[model samples]
Target: MRYHVLCGIVVSGLLFGSAHPAFAAGPVRLPSAATVSSGAAAAASVPQQLVKITDVTNIRQTPSLDAPVVKKAQPGQTYAIVETVAGPGGDWHKVVLGEDKTAYVASWVVETAENKPGKSSTGQEKPSTGGKQPEPSRTILNIIDVTNVRAEPDLESAVVAKAQPGQTYTATGTEGAWYKVSMANGKTAYIASWVVTATTLSGSAGQSAGQSAGGQVFIYHTHNRESWKNVAGSKSGSSVDDAKTNITLVGQELGRVLQQKGVPAITANDDIAGRLVLKNLSFTQSYSESRKTILEAKNTNPALSYLFDIHRDADVPRSQTTVTINGKAYARIMFVVGTGNPGYEDNAVFAETLKELLEKKYPGLSRGILVKSAHQGNGEYNQSLSPTSLLLEFGGVNNTLEENKRTAAAFADVFADYYASVQSKSK
Candidate 1:
């Protein structure tokens, strides 16, 4: 029996180091009486304390000894201290390099102003009003799907919280490239500066210094187990299915590419076929199981604006599903738009926009948009979730995984441009 392609898709840390010999020849400078007094006055006006370099040391990207040295600090050089992190070798001080930059220095090489001898009990020795005024706090806008909030301003530090896209946090200060943010739990955590944009929050108007746009894009697989001929090792038939090697990998690749292009995306890897078996449902009910997954994702993240149900086509010849672009083989893609939903026109237009973008960039890489009705497989494909929803078939069963991945990257390239254009218009 020639198995036809089912559109609804059945399927399926580092340590710290010690000072080096090169710095040993130089005379180490400790905080003098005048320096201590100046540091004390500076500390009173700033939210963070100041630390003086006690020895010639290297400032590192992280709190570990093996971390890359970002700068060389000489003795007597003073930096405002963001916080102290305990490393494997010893405690490391996170210090501010500039307005939005920070670095780490060994605790053994730096001395805090408060640690000086003859420190007053009531802190009366320091003049409070004469120091530089503190800068106004800014708001942090997370542009990624999820980012780790570390206990310290280092990647090796423990993750204390998770920041989500479209969410804003109060940025208290900055260390190197890390933002010291006040978390919801009344505790402060550090988020990498690369994943977020710091903006000044204007009073009452709720306006940020930068543009706050780009909603979350959700990608999931309905037929999660759909596999290719070479990877699944199937001897015959039109399609293959595997639990481990499947279409979900393509979805993940697409999500990764989107993230690299600055678009916030989340890829869902729920086992739809396995869930159906456990629920005693048939393969035809794959969309039903995947719908639950979509709804759950939507409930978890209301910022999700673009929804995608990724699948692999079957029963098509290898020649039809594969294409050569720039001397590299890539699995051709198809956009399947279901007309069963009330707002499917919007979905169709969305799919058409993507298809046009894809074809313009990589000609013959797209098989065009396939309009389907209720009679043609599961017509809705859970696209009613959003007007921008789409069902994408990223190659056929006859194609290889590598081809699918290449096509995923190509599609992400097109989609990212399209997404940016849309976001620009919305502004």
Candidate 2:
């Protein structure tokens, strides 16, 4: 149902040539003849607009006819609710479009619905009225080794509070490591920036995947399809359901990497086995609600210092789908951090650690951490359960299934190297 909502959304408002021969093929229906008048405006304060042509159009770089193109829109480009003055020469009214990407558009081709007019009101008197909005939710960070919440922006500042590797905290806003946050009380206070790791925000550039033990990794698309109902990518057919697969592969890889370094490590599936490697520990929904499937593997596994949830992105481009053995485009990886929970700082630290290690080994294959919106992707996805937890998106849907599968195997190898390194450090 939710995916359907995403599918229906038009990213931008642009129309080229007509898709169908005609615009109106059906008869128009009128509202009941006797309608009572309502005082409320027909449309809300938020903006709205529509596309003009029958087919999709591209959002261009400039407002003119010759502007460079950015992205294309599907039929019925949906614009915000607002008035658009006509663009130069063209019948198109210039407008901005899309939720994830706010590209601009022309209006001549699209038509605006008859907006119910709004009454005149004081425009300058609103922001001050809403006092102290509620504080946002917090997240816990697990798997970090050492961390401290400080008073000032710099590391030299006094330690206002201290947090362990797997400790939890309520994250608010940030300036470097200094966070302006609410105390356990109702009032807000400033905490040291270094005290907590900062998560990547939404729409930020992704980290590039590099070669460590694994140059590229992909999660099997069929894994999710075979397990869940219809959640796999219907369009791309490459999206995994959750992060458990990444964790399982990592665990197994760690065993082999440890053996290579003479550490005598053993690994098994944590969800299917139910071995009680760790008791009662679990991540929250922002991590994933369905991780209960992992219950089967956890029963049969060994205790681990970290837990990872691996996955991949969808609606990606085909150019990013190529994989080469040496000096070639294989697969890209994405790291995600959720800001809607208590351990945001801790989780950020863990993400940074993983990125640092993976970058050193893989070079450019690992993409940076993606700051997730609370509105989508498990909402913090499963990071809140432990400090060491992370949700990794391997590649977009367009990537070939085999490339993605080979990428996953490569990830397994990198995890092995990371495990050996961590063991040596603990010693």
Candidate 3:
């Protein structure tokens, strides 16, 4: 259901291109609590904060573009912020439309006065309000790890949020090693101060995948339906649902590279997404369907140790899909590993090694390894079956299949070195 929400979202007065919103232009939405240091900065204001509209924008009833438009917001018009939400569609700012009515505008459409030290008042001012206690001195801290934002300072308390790696938060106060962080919606959450770094945020690089390659490798994709069109010198059509046309070609490309490098690699062209159709199951069942194929392969040949699941990313905008390395176009890759299973460390090391190898040779090719848990999309991905299993996202829907194939070639080159190193070690 959520992936469906991310397929495509168009909002008015966009900071990025009008065609499709850029990935960096919007908030990263995961199944469960992922991470965000700017949770407090994420929402609009709690008490009505004044703002001036910078563009002609639609006033929607809800945060998503899918919501009905209440009216058109005029430029230079002043309105008070009622609330703000970082929805899958993008950031929406709730504002007063009239004396008794309200609607939401995209965050990009307005200039918030809340950026300043104090609040702004309406021209029709009321009587003086009672004095209030001074807010505590706030300290901005950088999250050094994937730490949980708790309901209370104590660990036993419920997890209200997750401080994603490299995200910064404004802490109001502290109780021992825990610091109190304020959120945009006016709620307070706590994160372990020790888990956060005091100085700065982490950069765009990734960690080293430290491990030798093991056994023959298996290559597959759960989102096998991911495809591209019109870029490989084709005049018409986009992604094909079948393996021969879509991401499967990318997998085959990588496999060819691996085989050329003398490493045995197999590409399982099972239409994992199509299996869900046969079962009449939701799209989430894709992992389950692919897992069966992986197990069968492993059972038939134990040499299949390492696994790669390749698919295109739809969550990010298309402009971000292409990254030029040495003036050549290539699809960027994000390695996602689930922590709910037993082989997390091994998988992480494997993923990290692949990233390190790729970045070392290609540079900016890997988007760092993103860790997910049972709390997030949660299928074991059957990765637990092998220590070196990985789920790789290459580019997005906007990327042409040809661009993805180029990336696959680059990835295969780096992987060959990694596989050869492992083989040498095992021997």
TM per model? Answer: 0.58, 0.36, 0.47
Cα lDDT over the full model 2: 0.41
Off by over 4 Å in 2: 1-223, 226-289, 294-302, 321-329
The positional error of residue 146 in candidate 3, measured at the CA in angstroms, is 45
Q: Pick the candidate with the highest lDDT.
A: 1
Candidate 3 has which clashing residue pairs, if any? Answer: 23-317, 35-164, 40-184, 209-352, 209-353
Q: Rank the candidates by TM-score, best first.
A: 1, 3, 2
Regions of candidate 1 where Cα sits further than 4 Å from its true position = 1-214, 233-239
Which residue pairs overlap in candidate 1's backbone? Answer: 11-225, 12-224, 12-225, 12-226, 101-176, 102-175, 102-176
285-325 in candidate 2: lDDT tens per residue? 22232344333222212132344555446665756634465
Q: Which stretch of 10 consecutive residues in model 2 shows the poorest summed lDDT? A: 208-217
- Tell me the whole-model lDDT of each prediction, alpha carbons only: 0.68, 0.41, 0.62
* lDDT (Cα, tens digit) per residue for candidate 3, span 240-265: 34445678888878876665555656
Clashes of 3: 5
